[model samples]
Target: MRWPLTDAARVVAEARVRQGWSRVRAAWFPILQAAVAGSIAFAVGHSLLGHPYPFFAPVSAWIALGFTSDRPLRRVAELSVGVALGVGLGDLVVHVIGTGWWQVAVVLFASAVIARFIDRGAMLTTQAGVQAIVIVGLPALGASGGPLGRWTDALVGGAVALAVAVLTPSDPRRRTRAMARVGVEELAGVLRTLARGLAAGRPSDVEDALVRGRASQPTFDEWLDTATGARDLARVSPAARRHRDELTALVQAAVLSDRAMRNARVLTRRALPLLDPGPTEHDLHAVGATVVDIAAATDDLADSLATGRTPDRARARLVAAAQRLDPFVLAPDDWQVQSLVLLQRSLVVDLLEIAGVSPRDAREVLPPI
Candidate 1:
């Protein structure tokens, strides 16, 4: 009873600590990005063009728009184009129609509509509309510097933003590598939980494994996306590219292994309702032990992927243990033996493939489990 209460308290405490850390770290990323953008905009606009408005305005707009989403380039381009069109249209309209509510309404509406059409171009509409207002809404004490000034400013700001984005770009390869490490660690965690469930012969353990397997899918998808993006960026180092590919394959293999494990869990759960006449303690322990070994091997494979280091020793040990659990050789009637074999085979195939060995060659080296 005390143990359960203590465990609950500890979980709560850990959750709070994690929450606090996340909040603290969250600010660092956005602020650092914003500052970098602002500095670049200022330097380019103020020093080179002698016009700070061009740099600051576009950069500020990018930051305000939250360019950190999945598509930073698209967002920046959209907003910059929107502003440019809006400013250009507004200037053109003011020249044609004298300042009035109707003129303002017309320019805003026209700019918004054109902006919408310009790029996929939802923001273009807003961009043009706002620019129209800026050009004609305010009264001028002195002669207008004209549309040229506004256009120049918008162009400068956009150019600065684009330059910053292209120059100090975030490498997708690095992101993939980071995710691989986390994914592998998570794989290890999942395997441990799964092994425990199988060992206890509980339907709940199998169900939990299924749930974890589903949850893990996003990690693989995200890694794939990052890898594809990084490969496209072509800015990653040669070592990074190779490593990224290896990690990608490793994750793909993990997904397959997870699926196999899931199927085995389902079988185990189904067997739970069926009556087992009698089983020797030794037989039961063997089932549990085999499941744990399978998990350990899978975890080792995941670790290798995360760290770029192969688990040669663990792989060998797993191969040896899997052979011992062979249904054809060891325990013929044990259904658990069949399930364990499936997991073992799936993981071995994936691991070997990730190591760049051919499937036939891997089979030659790996004995049937």
Candidate 2:
């Protein structure tokens, strides 16, 4: 017999290749960012003569600058104020106490305390405390002149960072679009998985789906962020607007499907006692298998959406599976039947809506709703 080791190794190698590609791309971003920051610092320092604190200002300004015009101006303002306050506090502590280990202790403690007191930007105040320590510790800079020079430098750096951010704004719109795509993919996965469990009508499969869904919540959050950001990008084109709406609707539909699947699973578990005679068990198992097939189709549809194609077959099968589950109403377990019917109907309607079909069309597609 041929060994399976080679096949397993191939699978592992492919996974590593994908992961390495992602990491390599990510690595380039920080390198580019550092280069830009360094260039600004050097240019600003060289341009201004009497400004004396050129290097500090450019760096500070760059730090203060945000990626887009959309970033809150308030944040830059907060950053500037925080730096100023920290530098001032550090200078004050150094001048009053003089230099020693105790002075260092005072600076750190005061920085931490001031940082905490600032409430919103604790990092700012602590930075100020550290600046004070530098002022006191470095004899070459001296106690008097050095503190002022450092503060001026800090101001210059903030200004440079801010100016760069404002002048060469990066568009966040593409990032938002990418995020929306991720959300759409996740919604599809959950729906497909649940659809599979429904078709199988097996409680164990349904339970497994629940675990998968919980793990997807972070992806849901990421998608939600993308949707919100896309909306904020203020795109005026009809196509862009429509895409945003579709993403929003997709998230809603996923939520509805999740709820419906959970309710249906609970109903099935409760109805297990009533599965009864061998013939009913056989029929139920058959129905469950159909549900599983439907789920597989849904997963395919999700894959289609990611690839920019319509999943018409999956859509049709989902509606058909809902109809097949309808006869469960005739079962002896009245409560279970009612619950399962409710959940099944909800999922069918949501899935249809995602396929751009109206609720009425979905119900008509059902088998005698």
Candidate 3:
């Protein structure tokens, strides 16, 4: 029992380490940007503004920039406004009312209400209240450059963050493409797992495929979000505008692939019951082989999307697989098998659309059941 528990612990630890590494890979660039922006902010506040401790300078810069390339210039401006408003109000309130429990409560309420009135953004209101509380809690001793010195430091930070955001060179499509590849690869894996399960008539394999598909939802969601962010960046950045059409196609692919993944999960779930009563005389090997073909097509589609290449090969393979999804011919007399085929047909249609096929063309590729 101890050995088993130790093994389980080791597996969990390794999985967590992998997740952490993946996050680091995805966020390293944004992290570097934030760090640079903060250092610059602190330098400007401390050197030019003559603030000895200019602590809020780096704080405001880091908060405004954050650790994601998805942030647009407008978002950075909004965050900066939030930080400045919070620090200014906090300093004013602390100077007037002095630091105390009641002062803290009063400043928080006033700052939050004022922030809400100024902007509808939640970050603005929350930051305002939080900064006001910080001001009231900290000692006012050793403060230089007057009561508004900290506020000035925050302004310097905000300005530095805005400058950094505008000057930074970024390819908006890169992250979106990476996320799309991850999503489509996971979808392919699910299909391949489902294929093996169906070919072997193993209910456990089908269950495993279903579990993997469900777990992949977050990846699909992230893909969609990254695509949306790319679109937003294209709207704002001149350099990214040229790729708007490509970004739009990627967004569509993300949506279609998410649907494909959902349909695959449903198909996997439905397949489990058919195989649950132990292996029957009905040979599912051919059906499984068809699923493997679809998985291969999905892999090709992922490669095309990731590399900015034409998906002609993927489309061709998907069209061939689509032609084979005829329930009436494939499953014949077995209604249960026929139902699974129909679900697979839907999944194939989604993949076809992701590969740049029109809805009508994608549907027309499938033989009527």
lDDT tens per residue, model 3, 47-143: 9988888999999999988997766776788788888888888899778878898888888888888888987978888887887787778889735
The superposed Cα distance between candidate 1 and the true structure at residue 116, in angstroms, equals 14
On lDDT, the stronger of 2 and 3 is 3
Largest TM-score belongs to which candidate? 3
Each candidate: what lDDT? 0.55, 0.52, 0.83
TM per candidate comes to 0.60, 0.51, 0.85
lDDT of 2 by residue, 279-335 (tens): 444334443454455556556555544444576876877776767656544333554
Model 1 / residue 366 / CA error / Å = 5.0
Mind giving the per-residue lDDT tens digits that candidate 1 earns over 6-61? Answer: 44455345434543443344335645655666666556555666653453354444
Off by over 4 Å in 3: 1-22, 44-50, 105-122, 142-146, 232-242, 277-279
Please give the range of 10 consecutive residues that has the lowest summed lDDT in model 3.
Answer: 1-10
lDDT of 2 at 323: 71
Clashing pairs in 1: 54-157, 86-128, 112-125, 115-124, 115-125, 116-125
